[model samples]
Target: MLEFDFCSTVSSIFSTPFSLGMFTEPLMLLAETAPPEVVAGDLAEPSEESLFSVGGILTLGMLIVLQAVLGFDNLLYISIESKRVEESKQSMVRKWGIGLAIVFRIILLYVVVKVIALLQEPFLNLISHPLEVHLSGHSLIVIGGGAFILWTAIKEIYHLLAVSDLGEEGDKGEKGNSVTKAISLIVTMNLVFSFDSILSAMALTKSLEIMATAVILSGVLMIWLADHVAEFLKKNRMYEVLGLFILFIVGVMLVSEGGHLAKIQLFGYHVEAMQKSTFYFVLAVLIIVDVVQGRYQKKLLARQAKLRLAEQPSA
Candidate 1:
């Protein structure tokens, strides 16, 4: 009879460095000692499936949909930013900006896959009675991007409010933005927007090819849609305010997300991330209100015109 000391065997198993062999050793030993009539089947190593497999294809489709849903604010930003450039070059800016962003996004996806842990490691620690913030690389980037976007939205809103003459505003608009500067801003913000989608994609699948494909396809869609969105905004100028306010909300959402990631505490209160559902709900309310207000204003103007015509002498 072959007697085995279970405690010693377990101790030896743990003492050795972990490997596939460690798992197989016990099983092999069992097979060797078992009756001759009993036989063990060969263990085969796992192989990676091709990217075109059913699972991979499904993941790719899901990732593309995720990109589109997350890219709404990004698309809005691109449309508005492109308009800042010369009208003739606006389309070019959008295309080039999105094109460059696609390349950078792939690069970023690679980097994140390689050094995700490094990005999450907390680098900044500030603790005080009134304020507390533990910021990582990811959080800092998100917070900075959020701050810049908030500032831009607020500045534009102020400009709109300060404009007393439509003609002067039109002249200012005609001055336009430097093509390089506009494209630079669009590309930079596009990356900021990409972070969320990239992180979400990482959660979905580990395949870089799938994520990159989604990013490229989404960028092409944005380029194609950019002109239509900008033209709509141009034709319906009143909706510009609605767009700006939407951007303001996006900035707020980003700031809150960053704060949550950093575990920030202000005045002893913890900062929490804003839910996406809340954001969409607010957006829907804003759109509904805008549509209602526009129709109401048109009706009021028509009624006033009828009143004026009634008061005028017959002609």
Candidate 2:
């Protein structure tokens, strides 16, 4: 009954938005962070090919699908972030935020391809006999982005717990978000999320056009799904706890990646990226456990009700 009411309320809230979407950062978070792989062996630069050529079309199609898969975490973040805004303006914020993401990605796609080597250069380094540290623009970005996400996740969790009754950060979750601020944060994090996948895309092919096309297509899909994802979460609030924890873990992974990129070492232990396969396996286990636990609890409640009825008849 509680769940049913929640659904009805969600329907009333989003009835007009016909709305809108993350899927990537968390996967990276659970795995070891590594610099984007630059494909080995000299591959030919992307050449201008006929749009209708079988190879070009096939490559473009594969990339589009891949972008959607890789961007799920990205889409999830957008969905969650949009909910932090004024209810009346959520639809607009989500739509505009995604539009900006598409544009920023395209611009970033070209810039990274042009000056990627410069971005990879380490700009600072320090060392001791058993420990060393280095930092680069890329590493800095990862660290900064990770820190922001960590702060946001922790803050949201606190809000969920109502831990602010004694202070300013406590219960103002009902306040409307500044549209500008929300959009800015979305765009910034979206770029951080793109850093790796964009590199992976380059490793597969040299054609910038193919990458751009895939990005645009995926953004379109995101715009379509964003509202719907937000609504689902609003109705099924329990799952939002799971989503917040995933975001928190993603922040941890990004920070680890930054540490790895800087090649930090302490007490003879070098920082490293976690393996992707292991993280996915763990995520699968968590989902299975949550589902089983929920079902088992429901069954237990039903059993208790039966016992109560039997005792009443005896009395």
Candidate 3:
């Protein structure tokens, strides 16, 4: 039977030799102040104590809410990516993509829990007069994912502008590789978006089961919401532009976060991560502007139609 030592477990979960030593003293102080049973290793077994408790359940709820809040951009990406395939296969792609991603996310959570310190260790360092970057696994993954999303958004927006007939283009869907490609992209980006959420959950508690449960529940919610969002975009084609721009903002947020994580400096200027509050503020403004402009455009067209009717001779 495996023995459970509370102090050691907390220490291992939060820090390794390679990690910054900021947590070591605080953790030691906590261990010193804890009850004799907790500090002297006289506690109940791990299975009994950690699996389901008031604290664990409360942490679980917090994790679920965190996953949902962070997953909004990811959900948007899935909705838009699924639309590229045939109408019949789009739903399958979403279900399969998220299903596979859920399995992989659990796997990723396990792996990250084990080697989180290694992931944060700086593996690539570039120092020059003009550029300076300290790249780690986490930063590289986020930066790469952000760049891909940015490229996809720009390409899709360009296609929207270049196409002569929007309705005709919407009717024609891609065949052959579209379904496979869409699913692959959806799963990949889903993992990218999961990193920060997983790390945040880790900060709350060290229970793998609790975190995994939250992830599964959040993924289930996403699967249910995916189709509705896609259908909405389909019915209101004008909002597609709004959706794509939101995606663009998401990309920017990810890239900035990665740069901040890596402590990147270009031309002697540091890169800072965009705050979540700022991102949401900008998003709300964008949505309000889009809605107001759409309504104003409709009213203008209505007025034009009325004037033209009045100018015509009575029939």
Candidate 4:
């Protein structure tokens, strides 16, 4: 101790912070606990590798998966919208529509960060007794989106159920000029659908780098998968009806969610924030029953047709 020099003392003082090892302690514990441990050498230092080295890749994968799951409803809407175009152009419209929508979303993502709090403002209220309701920026998007979805679904269902068929058409009718309309509808709805995801991503991380990375990765996944979703519906035929019904339910969900965002209350109860798990559960049961009943009905019709043919005199 009597031999201490100024240089050594300064070095010791500077090294104290590093020796404390605030960051390394967590990594050591994480290495011990994290799966797929390496055993090439002693686990004491973790081979000087970072425990969070792969966090970027892992986060990208997770965001992609989450985006795909959340975008199912958007995909369904896209497919339905694309059908308004001529058969030859439907695929192209879907591809381009989704592409443009992604670009728009990226722009909106940047803009939203500055105005995130604007979406939370309350514009109006409800009756007495502390029951309140108001329209905020977020609510406007959601409610408007829901209303649009509901209108489209109802129109499609009506056309499917009531309209006789596509039938014959004049040349002008055949050139419905519907492709542009389809693209516009899809792009508009895509923007509407982007609100929830963008807002959620903002809440998740403050880093613009992280948010941008996640959004771009998710957009790429949607672009790759949207066409497949459309084609699946095109091939299934019967599932189109099911898809329409699902769209209706999604519309209802969006309206409820928007109302909640707006803080709207009905009577004394808040109908908007009701748990949608129950709605989905009941809908699943209903779909199962509908499928069984449909199969039974088809079988009965087939049996009747067979009996009638058998009862006919031989030709």
TM-score of every candidate relative to the true structure: 0.83, 0.79, 0.84, 0.73
List per-candidate RMSD values in Å: 14.7, 12.1, 8.6, 14.2
Query: Which candidate gets the maximum lDDT versus the true structure?
Result: 3
The segments of candidate 2 whose C-alpha lies over 4 angstroms from its true place after superposition are 1-50, 163-173, 308-315
lDDT of model number 2? 0.69
Write out the backbone clash pairs for model 3. none
What is the C-alpha local distance difference test score of each model?
0.76, 0.69, 0.79, 0.65
**Candidate 2, residue 285: how far the Cα is off, in Å:** 2.1
Question: Quick one: RMSD of model 2?
Answer: 12.1
Question: Which of the two candidates, 1 or 2, achieves a greater TM-score against the reference?
Answer: 1
Q: Over the stretch 222-307, how does candidate 1's per-residue lDDT look in tens digits?
A: 88888889889888889989999999999998899889879999998999877666777788899999999999999999999999
Q: Write the candidate numbers in order of decreasing TM-score.
A: 3, 1, 2, 4
The 10-residue segment with the lowest total lDDT in model 1: 38-47
TM-score of candidate 1 versus the correct structure, residues matched by position: 0.83
Q: Which parts of model 1 have CA positions greater than 4 angstroms off? A: 1-49, 171-176
- lDDT tens per residue, model 3, 1-315: 223354464466456553222232233234223332332232222434354887677667766776877788899999988987888899899999999999999999878756666777789999998899999998999999999999989988998899898778889843445778889999999999998787666555556788899999999999999999999998999999999999999999889989987989999999987766677778889999999999999999999999999999998
